[model samples]
Each structure stands twice: as C-alpha cells, then as structure tokens.
Target: MADQTPNSDAYRRGMVTRRSVLGDAHVDRAQANTTSFDAPFQKLITEGAWGTVWSGDQFTKRERSIVTIALLAALGQDEEVAMHVRATVNTGATREDIREALMHVAIYAGVPAANHAIKIAKGVYAEMDQQAAAKDR
Candidate 1:
C-alpha cells in the first residue's frame, strides 16, 4: 500500500542516519539486543522516523534535534532526552539551543517537565564536556 517499504531505500538510509546521530556504539548495542519480538518495531522506527523524516532535506539535523529534545522533555521521556541530548554533538545543537527548547517546553508542556529535563540536560552536558576534556588531555 505504501510507496516505499522498509526493505527499500528507506531502511538503509535509516540505518546510516541512526548510526550517525546516535553513534556506532549505541546503535550496535541496540542491534545486538534486537530479537524477533521487536525487530518489526525497530524496523518501523528505522524506516519511518530515521529514514523518511531524518534523511529528508526539509530541516537540518540540528533543527530536528532541537525539536526532538523539546518533545522528549515535554513527554517526560528522561532516558530518550538524555540520549538525544548526547546526539546533539553530532546534530550541532548547542547547550543554549537546548536551554531555549526547554524554555518552550516549560511554556507549552509544563514547568515540572521542563524542570526535570533541565536537570537531565545539565547532567548529560556535564558528562559530555568531561568526556571531551578527557580526549583533549
């Protein structure tokens, strides 16, 4: 019924995009953990979200990352927020951009959600900065 299936170009593109943004280690762990039970769901997200949406030219990866941060914060998805926040390094979204996104979340989503996300962001950013510093040293 659909024009392009997951096994088509979309799947491959999705794999590349997912790996690029999330990094090889994270993607590898996910792939290794994948079983027949959730393979279809993973395929759907890979093909639909990563392949179709992320691979498109409408918005840069940075913009998508910013919006995704806001959505995850609003939804109180702390784990995903942490993961995507880390992906900001590849997506080119700055800490300031993340702060602004959290501000929007406060207004549209809720103050509590934004507050919790702020904590998560701070922790993740600190860890990332520390890692970068270690690399430099």
Candidate 2:
C-alpha cells in the first residue's frame, strides 16, 4: 500500500469518486468492513486509483467504465468485472458499450476471459433488475 494518508486531499477526492461510482451502500459497507490490516490497502486504492486515475478529466466516466470493464475482464478479475459492470449504471455506459468492449476483449484477451466476464456482467444485470423490480413493488 502507498504511504498515502487517509486525511489527504487525494483520499478525500477519491472517497467522493469511489462513492459516486460504487454507490453509497457499497462504499459504506466497504468502509465498515475495513480492518487494520487492510486499511492501508484501501487508502492506496482510494488515493491512487480513484483520485488520480478516475478523477482525471480526459475520459468521460462512460469511457472509463467501458475501458475498466475490458481491462478487468482481460485480467480475469471476475469480481472487479462484475462490480464495474454494475457501476456502468452510474457511469452512463450502456449495455451496448459493454458488449462492444467484451467483443474487443474476446479478440485481444481471449474468448474464455470475455465469456466469463460476460457471465458475471449478466449476473450483475439480473441482480440490478431484481432490485429495480423490488423498488417498484
């Protein structure tokens, strides 16, 4: 983990960005679950990944979402892939965008990786749909 302080500006900005992308419920759960052993790790991701990379203005959140999903898929990060796929709702990435990204992943990464990521994405979508349905009831 980076030697970044939790009170730093980067951490603060990252918390907002992380919450924006991952939702308050998820963020809150993650924070609640943070242990002393993993606290530094959490700070590193929040300051570096969320603050520096995600907070950059070059790519729209939608573009970042598509790229992140593809990279996570290629790397066989199943859980991260699903999390990012769910985050597409907040990022404004449509299903079509995710489909295209996975197509590229199939070609560039591997069919198996893309296939598994697609499966995860589908599962996340189903859960999201179920949540939406529950809200409507």
lDDT of 2 by residue, 7-116 (tens): 98889999999999999999888888888799988989999999989999999999999999999999999989989999998999999999999999999999999999
Q: How close is candidate 1 to the true structure, as a TM-score?
A: 0.93
Local distance difference test, each candidate: 0.92, 0.92
Task: State every prediction's TM-score relative to the real structure.
Answer: 0.93, 0.93
lDDT, residue 1, model 2: 30
> What TM-score, to 2 decimals, does candidate 2 have?
0.93
Indicate the worst ten consecutive residues by lDDT in candidate 1: 1-10
| Model 1 CA lDDT for position 6 | 56
RMSD of candidate 2 to true structure, Å: 2.9
Off by over 4 Å in 1: 1-6
What is the lDDT for 25 in model 1?
A: 94
Clash counts per candidate, in order, are 0, 0
Model 1, 54-105: lDDT tens digits are 8999999999999999999999999999999999989999999999999999
